[model samples]
Target: MVKVSIFGSTGTIGKNVAFTLAREDTVDEIVMVARPESLDKVKGETYDMYDALAARDIDCRLTPTCNFHDIEGSAIVLISAGIPREKGMKRLDLAVPNAKIVAYYSRQVAKYAPDAIILVATNPVDVMTTIALEASKFDKMKVFGVGNHLDSLRLKNYFSRHININSSEVHTRVVGEHGDHMVPLLSSTTIGGIPLKYFVEYVDLDITGLVERLKNAGNTIISKKGATEYGPAYAISNLISTIITDTHKVLTVSCYLDGEIENVEDVSLGVPAVISKRGLEMIVPIHMNDIEKRNFMKAAETVREATYEVKEHMNM
Candidate 1:
């Protein structure tokens, strides 16, 4: 049995994550925390979750609170508290405020649940993840952001649609910034263990437009819907379940690097990493072509700059 704590349980992603984890038999308890102002809403969401679980006859204990102390003994503390991006806003546009929010909660996590693995889902997640790592003073491996995992899922979907193949057979990755400069690792993508190039020689994959569409996918959803909910929810829950089960799945996520990849350090950028019960087990070194390398470095710089800006904004 595992106890998980969600810092922003009232938001769309948080709510979705709560419901998804509730269904997981490994997650025996969830502590849903909201700000004092949203205490009532969180309590209601908890009751609502209880009702849903009862309907399905799943016996997961759920608690809602505005108190940070209640998060004690949690094995996972997911931080999703931040301003949701507006239609026209870039993810970086949320850096300053979200950094502050993440920092505050990181400290609380450190105090109440220092052993917990921190999964940051706030907007501008890469930057917020770095802030969380610093503020919580946790080992870098224990703190990670959920962005590239979601991006990779989107990449897989796009590949499946264009190639008309089963999505399960399409293995692709998107690294670097989870934002505009994310690098779609076409160099490493495979379909049923076959290199993408073999198929590219025959099929018109429209690689250029594919990356553009992948980059804009999140914004496109945000433009149509108020905010993205289910995709991230499912992706994050999969990650959580993997951790609880010690599956050690290799997933692309934003994790800190210190010579794990060339020339990138002290920043959280999206890359493929092995996820285990201990949190980030290792950052897998995948091959990248010249163009993919250049774009990935650029994305690293973009997130690094934004991370610095957030630090300065928060006076950290």
Candidate 2:
């Protein structure tokens, strides 16, 4: 029986995560944590867990509470509590506020659910992930951020259309920061054991424009729908499922910096990682072209700058 808790249960990503996990029989119980005043707000939602359980034929109960102490004994905790970025806004704009949120909850998790696998989905994800790691002082392997999974998904979707192949047949990754600095590994992309370049040639298409399009995919969605949640929510769910089931899946997650990528130091950014009950078990380093390497460095620098600012503000 897997016990789980969602810290921002009423928010867009949080709500979708809860709804998705609630449908799984593998999840024994799910606790939705919200601010004291927001409890009523959640209860009023259309697909709120309370309502879902009430209308269900099963005898299981879905717990919702504002108290952190009530969130104990969970195998995993998804932290989706943070501000969403606007279309034209930089993720750094959310640093101060989201850092505070991450710090506060980090202490709470340290106190109440120290062993839980903490999955962070907050904006300014890289910095907030660093804050959580420092504040919680938990094993670095046990805390990670939902970062480039959505970006990788977008890359695969675009590649599928370009190659006229099914998305499931494409294997690719978008590494580095989740924001504008994402590095798409075109060299590593493959369609049924064939290189992406070969597939592109077969289709007689230009793939250069598609790279920029994939990089700015989030802004496009935000411009159209105001905020992006569904894709990210699904990505987070996939990560959580791996941990809960001890699946040890390889995924792109924002993990701590330890000089694994050379010259990149002290920041969280998306890289291919093995996820299991240990949270982020291992960082998988992939080869990069000179341009992709430069972009990855830029992404690392952005996160490092943000981390410095967060430390200055919090005086940590």
Candidate 3:
């Protein structure tokens, strides 16, 4: 039976993950982990979530991490426990506090679920995911972050909205940092194999404004809802399902770069990668235009700067 562990079970993303996984037959057990202070609170919500699922004829073993002992034997460890970005907050600003939380849990996860796949879902994800990778001392292939996957989804959704088509008809990938530096590859993006420029002309759309909105989609949602959850929640669920089913699908996720792209050394950035039961199956290179190349490089620097900003707070 496949057992999955969620480290921030009480948070919005974690709760959403729990509810989504509760209906997945591939998941035989769902372990909800929380800090000791939040243990009882999460346990209460766990039962509430699981009971509701049960009423719908969905069932899975629900466990709490009051002791954190049962994190062992989990097939996947999703680290969503960290400082969330608030209104008017830049993702990089949450780096320090979230890094501390990520570091401590990364150590514990390394000690407990050493063989499990580690996926980070925190803000400034490029920085925090790298922190988790280094702190856990795990092979880079064994860990990653749900970064541009969410960004790409948002990009596709926004483009699809403008064209008045189902998002599935759009084939797009957003790369680079998961923040303001993200690059939505227009050269490589297509709609039903149609170039983005074709759609802009056909729809008489403003390309520049559309790209800006795509970049700030997160802040846009958080401004009204106080949090952005639905898109990320389902994005992560898709990743989790891909892993559970061992589907070797390429997703725009955050992984280490050791010459994958020149000049960026020892950092995590969002790029095309194949994910399967083995975690990072492979990294795929995207053909970039001159402008995209410059932007991708700038994104690398932005990610490194974000990490440096949080470096003083981390032991590494």
Candidate 4:
């Protein structure tokens, strides 16, 4: 039985995660934590959410608290507490403020849930993951962001819809930051070991155009709904399941490069990794051609700049 704790469990992504995990048999406990200032509000909100879930017969031991000790001994710790990006606001625009928030909570997480796998869901996630990892001083493998998984899923969805095929049949990946600089590997995408091009001639598939769309998919959803929830919420829950089950699945996730890719190190960016309870057990760098390598490097540079910006913000 795995015990998980969500630091921002009253928000859209947080509530969805709480509700989803409440029904999972493997999840023995769920602790929904909020910032100290919003303790009462978050507790009330969690109670209401639990009531609603109970109405649907989704039962699990869900506890909401503002105490840091409640997060201790957690098998997984999810940091999703941050502001959403508004229209016209870039993901990098959120770097400074969200980094401070992530770093503060990361220290608390370090002190309490020292051994828990830290999963960051905050925006400009690559930057936030870097801040969290540095602040917590945890093993790099145990800290990651959920951005790449969602981005890759969006890429797979695009291919699935275009060819009228099940999404699971397509194997593709999106790397780098979770924003405009996201790199989609289209040149080598395959479906069940067959090249993607074999089926995409159905229409003049614009690879670059599709990548641009994949980069903006979150913004599009934010425009439609006040926030983008389902994809990210499901992405976090899926990762939790992956870690708890020790599936060691090779999924794209945002983590510090270390020697995973050329010219990108000490900065957090999305890359394919084998994930399990031991955290990112392996780096599965997707084979990138010359052009794809250039794109991925460009994306890595963008994240590197954001990390520098975060450092500047901290000094200020």
Candidate 5:
């Protein structure tokens, strides 16, 4: 059976993930983790969303509990259980508190389901991914952050509209951070195998403004709504699907750095990576211009600073 456990299953991303997976026939068991007091909230919300499907008699199991032991035996664990950032809140503001949560859950995972693929979906995800990796002592490949996948999706969608092309025809990747420092690889981006520069020349689109729009996409969503969750839930669900099915798809996710990209160290940042049954299989390196390289380095610096803060608090 394809067993899955979602930490913070009562939260926006977690509940949406459960709702999405509940609709899938491939998911055999879903364990929802939350506080004991939150059990009814999860059940009520889930039933309210799935009652129609339940009336139709779907055959999937939805188990809600406060116990971490219930997460054992699951093939994948989606860590969406941390504070969501407010409109003006910086990623660093979340570092210390979320690091403690990562530590707590990492110990639980180590004790129970050490073999499960750990998907980090918390804000400041790149840094939180490092905390989870170190605290769990799991293979770096098995721990990854849902980073630029959502950003890349937004970028492609924007590009498609600008060039009047189908979104599937546009292939793009956002690298480095999952935040404002993220670098959109315009040079490597393509529309139907043609360079984005050529497409821009043909369409006369404002490339500079497009990059800024991608950077501020989350802010725009948060400004409209209270928080951004739907896009992330969709992106994370896709990652879970890839892991569950052992699909070796290349995606932009935050993985541990080992001096691989320009000697970047001790941080997790978004880069093109292959994901399969073994989790993150490979970090694919792509050539970038000087400006893009600098942007990536700046993002690495920000992640490193946050890591240092977390480490100081953990005394690690």
Candidate 6:
């Protein structure tokens, strides 16, 4: 039986992820952890989820706690505990405070769940992922951030809508930062196994507008709802399912690079990686246009600078 532990279970994303994972037959148990002050909120969520599970006839076990030690026996540790992005704030703005929180829990996870795969969902996720990897001292493959995976999904959704095709027929990805500087790999985008550019020749697609919308997608939702819940929650659960099912699918996620792609070293950026039961199997190098390559390099620098700031705070 596979058990997963979620930190910051009281948050919107955490709660939604808990519900989503609970419905998976492969997930036998879920441990939800929140700060001491929010323990009641997690307990309420657990009871609420139990009712929902009973209605569906699912047998997934649920445990709620304020204790970090209870995270033991977890196969996957999801860290979503941090101050969420505000209406007008950039993801990078939450770096230091969130990094401290992530670092504290990362150390505890290292101690309590040494062999678990760490999935980080904190804002400025690219930086926070690097922080988790460093603080936990976990293998790079065992620690990653759910970064461009959502952005890639957004891109896929856009292509599907514009081309009037099922979303599963579109294959595309957004790389680099999970924020403003993210690069849409149009060069590699495909629809029905054909290059997107080929379809562009026959379809009237506004490439510029689509990319702009993709970049602003998160803030657009946050400006109205104060937080993005379902989209990220589902996206995270999808990645976890891939790992738990041992599917060697290539997905874009923030992972540490040690001179892996284009000689880029010592930073975690969203790149295509093969995810399986062991976490990342390999980082797949995709073809990028000259302009896309430049934009990607810039995005790397953007994340690297923010990561440096948080590293200073942690004195790493």
Evaluated with TM-score, which candidate comes out highest? 6
lDDT (0 to 1) per candidate: 0.91, 0.83, 0.87, 0.84, 0.86, 0.93
TM-score, model 2 to reference: 0.94
Name the better of 1 and 5 by lDDT.
Answer: 1
lDDT of 1 by residue, 1-316 (tens): 6899998899999989999999876798999998899999988888888887897789999888988888999999999989999898999999998888999999999999989999999989999989999999999999999969999999899989888889999988999988998999998889988998897887887888988998888889999988899999999999999889999999988898897986689889989899998999999997889999999889888899989888987789
In angstroms, the error of model 6 at 234 is: 0.5
Question: Which of candidates 2 and 4 reaches a greater lDDT?
Answer: 4
Q: For residues 1-316, what per-residue lDDT tens digits would candidate 3 score against the true structure? A: 8989998888999978877887766798889888889989888987787778877787688888766679898899999988888999998888898898988888988898889999999877899888999899999998899989998988888888887889889999999999889998998788987887776677767779988998888898999999988888889989999999998999999988887865567779999999999999888867889999999999988888778768755657
Instruction: Please list the residue runs of candidate 3 whose C-alpha ends up more than 4 Å from where it truly belongs after superposition.
Output: none
TM-score per candidate: 0.97, 0.94, 0.96, 0.94, 0.96, 0.98
**Model 1: lDDT of residue 240:** 91
Better of 3 and 4 by TM-score: 3
lDDT by residue (tens digit), candidate 2, 1-316: 6788888888988888887776654587778889989998765652456566566643334677888887798888888898878889888899999989888888899899988988899988888889989999998889999889888888888878876788989999998988878899888888978987777767766677887897777788899999888888888888888888889888999989788875577889999899887788788878988988998999998888889988999997
Error of 2 at 171 (Å): 0.7
Best by lDDT: 6
lDDT tens digits, residue span 33-60, model 4: 9867777777786677678767767666
Q: State in Å the error of residue 96, model 4.
A: 0.6
187, model 1: CA deviation in Å? 0.7
* Regions of model 6 farther than 4 Å from truth: none
lDDT of 6: 0.93
User: Candidate 1: lDDT over CA atoms?
Assistant: 0.91
Off by over 4 Å in 4: 52-58, 202-204
Each candidate's number of clashing pairs is 0, 0, 0, 0, 0, 0
Q: Which 10-residue window in model 3 sums to the lowest lDDT?
A: 307-316
